[model samples]
Target: METIGKGGFCKVKEADVRVFRELLKKSTGERVEVTGMQHMAVKVFNRNVLKGQKTSEFDPFTGCLKMSDQLQSIMEEIKVWERNSNPNIVKIFKLYNDPTVPEMYLLMEKAQYGQIQIDLEGGDYLTKRNAEIEVVAVAKAGVHWPQGSGTDLEKASKWIFYQVAMAMEYLHSELKISHRDLKHQ
Candidate 1:
């Protein structure tokens, strides 16, 4: 398994899985069995991480998460992901929750594009901790980045902004759900 991303208590790994799809047969009013393979990102959440954490008897919503732990939150997340089907949202295939195991696996579609890097105006690319940071140093008070020549870059940035905005709008309007944990990775 290839590790793709990481979280506070979990890590995502990429793996190949076999899937079966039912296709409609035009000639015979029947469905055809089709086998396919897909690359899936599995989120491995370790419940053992809660060992040292203090979980109070009084399940207050202050910081203890209303007495419910990360497991409950993950379950709720799985339900939301399983219900929603959109182009902007990543598709969740299956969730493996075993009582005997300390880890829970959440299977999801592998995202191809992680982050977009556009050389704005004159930003210096700084490689730090496996992530690239574009540092824009303004020399003067009225100076700005993305000077006139970056027309194509402006369009691409605008397009990305629109797509993210649309996705957020769809989640709020159509699904009536809000993503609490939004991250770059």
Candidate 2:
């Protein structure tokens, strides 16, 4: 697999065609061929970073006992993604756990435009301005928001803020959950 990105605790790779097919088959119980398919991003958590650590707590929302800090984080992320159907949030396709390995893989939709930080740094003036607008909108909404073009930043930012605020209100009031690490990225 070719490395596409990396973070402190995870590495994002361009999922290998063969491996992707195998994973899809395993996940869906159907043979899937990767022919002209959109590439999926595989986020592999570093085992070393999560080693020798565990946590157990009662989840107030799920009313179930959560175990292991790393495992809980992965499970919580998947749960949130599954519960939310917002267009602005990233979509998670599947979670792969190999018994032989300590690491876990998160199969997710690949963002075509890439990271916002890189875009802010290298993008044209308009792109940079739009990204800044998105950041401010997200902050105002207290959640994630989509970035786009061809509209006045003031009006577009307000709409983006409204959409994200509604989404967050739903997550908090209805789902009884919170995204503690909301950020521009």
Candidate 3:
């Protein structure tokens, strides 16, 4: 699989659904057939990235030095997203937890577009995490309207805001998960 994107502790790769099915079949030795588009995103997380982080649960029998803040966040994300089945949320197809390896793969449905970004006024962008994507370009037909009227743009913006609000509400109210700092790419 080829890497499509990368974050602080994870690399997202484009994987085919058929390939994933074969992987599962090889591991479980059970024949499986899947009918769908052969497109998905697999997030690979390296557990050893934050190996030096210390925690309060340090002990001899069961160590706690690996229980870092980043690791905890990663685990929580997987737990929450894997259990949810909402229309506004991303669906987790499968979780490939390699017991012998130091990495984990989260197979999920791929979105049609890339990460959303806001173009800053001074052209510097908001912290440089996301690419400078023009709002006008994303708005599609909303930008082209009759002169002296901003109703279309306003409606489009409101629609986008509403979609985001719905996703947030699903995450917070239904899943009890606070999506903190969903940075752009």
Best by lDDT: 3
Instruction: Give the alpha-carbon lDDT of every model.
Output: 0.58, 0.65, 0.66
Residue by residue across 61-170, what tens digits does model 2's lDDT show?
89999777665565666787776666665567667666577778877777654554443433344233446645665566455444533344455567665766887887
On TM-score, the candidate that comes out on top is 3
Per-residue lDDT of candidate 1, residues 87-167 (tens digit): 867778766666688877776777655444432332345322212211111222223344634644455446555666788
Candidate 3: tens digits of C-alpha lDDT, residues 1-79: 8776676678888877778778868876754343566788889988677344444434456654435566676676788
**What is the TM-score (0 to 1) of candidate 2?**
0.58
Residue pairs clashing in model 3 are none
Q: Which segments of model 3 are wrong by more than 4 Å?
A: 23-35, 53-69, 117-151
Winner on lDDT between 1 and 2 is 2
Q: What does candidate 1 score in Cα RMSD to the true structure? A: 10.2
* Residue 158, candidate 3: alpha-carbon lDDT: 69
